[model samples]
Target: MFVLAAALAATLAACGGGGGGGGQGGEDVTVASDIAYPPFEFERDGEPVGFDIDLLNEVGKRAGFTPEYQNVTFDGIINGLRNNQYDVAISSMTITPDREKRIDFSEPYFNADQSLLAPGDAGIESVDDLGDATVGVQLGTTGEITAREFKDEGTINGEIRTFDTIEDAFNALENGQIDAIINDLAVSQYEAKNSDGNAEIIEVIPTDEQYGIALPKDSDLRQDINEALAEIKEDGTYEEIYKKWIGRAPEEIPR
Candidate 1:
């Protein structure tokens, strides 16, 4: 029962916590991740813990495979998947047309949009007002893509600094190296709230993006993953996990 215009919701609890190589299994699945994006996939106590980790663990259990998470850079993750370094990957990756040409995606798991995080006093109320203000973004992310769009469209005639992680982007903003950070709403908000008043979300850019797990093209695991995801939702496991992490049940998670 998936819908085209569904609203995204989330819940969560810590699951699949660890950072390193996967153990050999009958069907070994190496899941590549950036391991820095929070509320989705980030390291805690030197281990991975977040929504994607928890969800993927359950999906693997239902799909009859062992899942192992490998930490990789956001820009390098796709290539790693293509080269067979990873059996699959999930790190809050948005399902985009350009990406689909090289890989396969499971059903959309989370709905997301872009956001601008700036100092509380920046007077940047909307994306339209970003003119002449430097923006920081994580390299190889939709945030970077959107920032470039703003520059190309003349919405902002300022510098765009690319960082390896969202944390670095936020640090740049706090240190005045940049004026704003354009990132996913949930991520930006989480960062800002914990920034000790150094950052605040100023604008929401509606892009209607959906996050999906990425797999190598022609991989036989795609359908099984999809089926497991469906079962997770149907059995209410998704809701419980969403509530644990997102603090609320999904209103309309895709399918």
Candidate 2:
């Protein structure tokens, strides 16, 4: 874990840029993203396109400024924000207290939790059945933290392989290098469903985590972004995007 964090920190330091609030000081409102987590932020035909990307673009438009997205490593996003290399980040980033201390977050734009993807015949009915199986999770994500916790508590007795991207973790699972991969429930389900029998989503770990757009500490853009978010939700744009990407709207997307 220390090694992973160190690598992530170095990655963060390499993505240096200026930041500003709104359109202040002639600085662009740059948004940093990993661009590898699919159905959230991924490259579509060499262009970033996903729920978070679309949502934030609209947020920027409504807030009276166009946003510039920078592709940063997932582990480096928060650090980039802390250093103000980017003005905001909407990279399916979970809102946690530790992150809240380093930077502020917009009201959650999406709710999510961990999911397990494994072969159909793996017999892994739930997260509990992985006592002796290797598990895969993306580096610096909640899934990695959860997997580590499970290992510490003896819930999973095998190794936890951390990959740089969900695709890599999924590939490891499909190639039999890992027993299962833990990731965001929706993305896990999407990948499994699209895996052509290579994998299946076995369980959804109900972490009740919420994803938010990250911002520099005390950033005044918070209120503006929140206001735009509220407008989108109230005006039905949010539901449209949700349905287009998630296939269905939830009971409610909490503000």
Candidate 3:
């Protein structure tokens, strides 16, 4: 099934003329997203709905294009962009030097940090407490990268498991299959809040990362998207979206 999907994406990429003629008119722009991370991007009533979706829709309106969303796994998003499988991506992806080498990004949109989530009674207070406990993280995310860093530095003296999605990692933690989960702070908090005492955020790992709208390297649409993003931020649309999805007004908007 995965192979067939990949083939279809490739075929679509080859035939879609790069998915929108460089932001001209109201062209349908192909968008790639891991549609399971809530508050950022997720599915509701069989349609994608979240901060990223709302923000991107507004962006499209101003950028003169319509975004045609494509649901995909988080790990595959970057590779898909590199292969021209999608025109843009807005999956709460952090802007990093390494990733910048492979793809371009609009200005930073959301500030973020890593967090440690575990059962409420796990007795884990911080990363230092997980001596030999299993740590779960979503595959290819900065959370996974942070976990590996801890393991390499002897901070985490245990197995580091990778899940296809953050939801999967949360399930493992809930089922006692893993001791804890390392993931984005906001997403972890969302899960913990909805867990009904099953889980809680044990610690916030401060990385000072920022999310950005990803684009194909050297994409012509970058300028249009960035301008639209700037407009959204300036006219208070960004704040409204932030408050709606994040449940509070942003303390500071990412630059």
Number of the predicted model whose lDDT against the real structure is largest: 3
* Per-model lDDT: 0.86, 0.86, 0.93
Off by over 4 Å in 1: 1-26
Model 2 agreement with the true structure over 137-245: per-residue lDDT tens digits = 9999999998898889888999899898888888888889999988899888779778998899888888999999899999989999999999998899999989888
State the local distance difference test value for candidate 1.
0.86
Per-candidate clashes come to 7, 0, 0
For each candidate in turn, the TM-score is: 0.88, 0.88, 0.91
Candidate 3, residues 1-255, lDDT tens digits: the string is 999999999998887665444344698889999999997998899989999999999999998998888889999999999999999999999999999999999999999999999997988989999999999999999999999999999999999999998888888888999999999999999999999989999999999999999999999999999999999999999999999999999999888
The alpha-carbon deviation from the true structure for residue 161 of candidate 3, after best TM-score superposition, in angstroms, is 0.5
| Candidate closer to the true structure by TM-score (higher is better), 1 or 3 | 3
In candidate 1, what residue range of length 10 has the lowest lDDT sum? 5-14
The candidate, 2 or 3, that scores higher on TM-score is: 3
lDDT of 2 at 208: 93
Give the per-residue lDDT digits (tens) of candidate 1, residues 79-116.
Answer: 88788778899999999999999888999988899998
